[model samples]
Target: MLMKSSKLLKLKFKHQLLMLFMALLTGTTMVSAQELTINGTVVDESGVPLAGANIVEKNTTHGAQTDFDGNFSLKTSSNAVLVVSYFVSFPKNQTTFKTKK
Candidate 1:
C-alpha cells in the first residue's frame, strides 16, 4: 500500500515538471513588454530642419544627433526621456519622446 502511494507521488511530480518545461518552451507563463522606437525630426524656431541637433537620452548613456536632413532614430524600452540640445536652439529639458506607430 505504501509503495503504491509513493509511485503516485512520483508520477505527480513528473507531471508537474513536464508542465513547467512546456511553459518555458511556449512562453505561456512569461511575458515581456513591447519595445519602443523613437523616430523624430529636429527643427529650429524657423521651422527649418536643424542639422546636427543633439538628442540624448537622459539618465542613460545612449544618444544620437540629427543628420543633415534633421532626421534621427532612437530606440528605447519605452517612452524615451530625452534631452534635446543645440547651439542654435533652446535647450529642451526632460523631453518626452513620441513613439512611432
Candidate 2:
C-alpha cells in the first residue's frame, strides 16, 4: 500500500520533469522571429540603376552591395531599417518606405 504510493509519486515527478524539459527546448527555438529576405534595386532619381551602392541593416554590421544592375538582397528581420549609400556626395538621409507584396 505505502510502497505503491511512493512509486506513483516518483513517476509523477519524472513526468513533470520531462514536460518541463520539453517546454524549455521549444521556447528557445521559438524565441526569435523568422528572418526574411528583402530584394531591391537601388536607383537614382533619374531612374538609373546605382551600381556599387551599399545597403546596410541599420544599427547592425550586416550589409550588402549592389550588383552591376543595382540589385541587392539582404536577410534581416521583418521590421529592420536599411541604410543605403552610394558615393559620399549622395544624400545619406534619403529615406525610403517599406513596401509589402
Candidate 3:
C-alpha cells in the first residue's frame, strides 16, 4: 500500500506539471493573436500629406481615414493587406505591411 501511494503521488505531480505547461502555451498563443495597431501617413506624389485619405484592410471592414496631417491609425491582425485610396476622383493603391511581434 505504501509503494502504491507514492506512485500515485508522482503520477499526479507529473500530470499537474503537464497541465501547467499546456496552459502557458495556450496563453502565449492567445496573446499572439491579439489585435495590433498600425500607424502611418498618407502622402501624394508631390510629397504632400493627403488628408481624409481612406485606409482599409483588404476584404474587411476594418478601416480609418487620415487626419488633417494625413496621419492615420487602425487596428488589425499582425498580417493584413491594406487598401489606401483617395476620393473617387483620385487614384487608388494597395499595400501590404507586416506588424512586428
Candidate 4:
C-alpha cells in the first residue's frame, strides 16, 4: 500500500510539471504572435534611394539594413520608434508607426 502511494505521488508530480511546461510554451507563442513587421524605404533629400541605410528600433537591438533599393523590414512591438540612419558623419532620423492586429 505504501509503495503504491509513493508511485502515485511521483506520477502526479510529473504530470504537474508537464502541465506547467505546456502553459509556459503557450504563453510564449501568444506573445510572439503579437509582434509586428514594419517595412519602409530609405531615401536621401533628393528623393533617391539610399542603399545600406541602417534602420534600428529605438531602445532595442532589433534592426535591419536597407537593401539595394533602400528597402528595409524589421520586426518589433507595436508603437515602436524607428531610427533611420545614413551617412556615417550625419545625424540619425526618427520615425514612429504603430502596428495593427
Return the top candidate by lDDT: 3
> Which pairs of residues have clashing backbones in candidate 1?
none
* lDDT of candidate 2 at residue 21, scale 0 to 100: 100
Q: Specify the highest-TM-score model's number.
A: 4
Every model's TM-score? 0.58, 0.67, 0.66, 0.83
Candidate 3: C-alpha lDDT: 0.92
User: Global CA lDDT of candidate 4, please?
Assistant: 0.91
Question: For residues 1-101, could you state the per-residue lDDT of candidate 4 as single tens digits?
Answer: 99999999999999999999999999999999878998888988888999999999999999999999999999987878999898777589998887654
- Measured with C-alpha atoms, the lDDT of residue 47 in candidate 2 is 91
Query: What order do candidates take by TM-score, descending?
Result: 4, 2, 3, 1
C-alpha local distance difference test of each model: 0.79, 0.84, 0.92, 0.91
- Model 1 reaches what TM-score against the true structure? 0.58
TM-score for candidate 3: 0.66
Candidate 4 shows a clash count of: 0
| RMSD value for candidate 1 | 4.6
Q: What is the C-alpha RMSD of each candidate to the true structure, in Å?
A: 4.6, 3.8, 4.8, 1.8
Which stretches of candidate 4 lie above 4 Å from their native place?
A: none
